[model samples]
Target: MPFTPFHMGAGLAAKALAGRHFSVLTFGIAQLAMDIEPLVGMLRDAPVLHGPTHTYLGAVPIACVTAALAPWLCRPLLRRWNQEVRHYRMPWLQESERWSPQVVLASALAGTFSHVLLDSVMHLDIRPWAPWSDTNGLYATISLSALHLLCMAGMAGGALGWVALQWLRSRRAAQRQRHNP
Candidate 1:
């Protein structure tokens, strides 16, 4: 429903899985899921009684399936990154061995489920079990929902922008160093 929840759910999910992916899997997949049209279609319509996403038919299966597949989806790149994780001393990441497939899968499932559950609660119209009925919307928390999305969008977008700026700065610095050195 809201971008904040989506970001949080995805991020938390990735963290819970723990591995080379850190940000990529935890945040990336969650965001990717939201971006995907079929999953998004469930959100756009808001069928009834919480719609398809609310239903076990949809949410549970999704979580389960993703958990099963996250590794195959991420393995090679993850292996490469795991080899290099040592170079990064990010505050949030503690140095650890590459995560086991089982751990990553569990975390991915948790992340997907968390997103659906959180969204269902936030959007009153979220009929997670759609096709069964059309109970419409849950009316949302109004200003809170708006604020949540606004803040999340600003934060996520800001983070990406910040990274881009840093990259540019680094590039220029490198060029200057090359010319002066």
Candidate 2:
């Protein structure tokens, strides 16, 4: 993807599918973490723009670091967002002081791995299994147009599913309020 939003499609899909079991914030952090090496190389005009960080082997450490740090980093932001966004109170953000280790690990791993696979599909320079092989057979296997569409489709599907889930929750809340009153 050009930046990282293309990767967010999958993260959002994870959120919609797994609900509280998936932490989209941690997943997003991992996406940004994995791209740091490429960004540094781009700024320095290095010979290898993708570098080792773009590989599966390199992503492991990055994902681990991101998973460990994301909770603390996200806490204050989530608190502030919860305060500001009164109508859409985020359950996860309602209190970011705590998080499930399993959720964070799952999200971070998913994020990093997906990022490598997605980039490998488009970037000819990406050797995801480097040191073992330099060839990127996955590259250009599908058209760029198709890849973009796939990412967009994931985003659209996630958005729709989230909206439906939210609507159902709200409706149930309203029904409970009416019955109680």
Leading candidate by TM-score:
2
lDDT per residue (tens digit) for residues 77-145 in model 2? 777767865657644224344578887888899999999999999898899998798988899899988
Residue-wise C-alpha lDDT for candidate 1, range 1-181, written one tens digit per residue: 3333444633533343433445345334544454353345556663432345444346556556666666666666666555665357432222233556666655555555555555555556555446675553433545556746654664576556545554565578789999999
- Evaluate residue 109 in candidate 1 and report its C-alpha lDDT on the 0 to 100 scale: 57
Candidate 1 lDDT (Cα, 0 to 1): 0.51
| lDDT, residue 116, model 1 | 53
Query: Candidates' TM-scores?
Result: 0.49, 0.86
- Name the regions of candidate 1 deviating beyond 4 angstroms: 1-6, 13-31, 34-51, 54-56, 87-98, 121-124, 129-139, 142-181
Q: Residue 86's C-alpha lDDT in candidate 2?
A: 64
Which 10 successive residues of model 1 have the least lDDT summed?
89-98
Top candidate (lDDT): 2
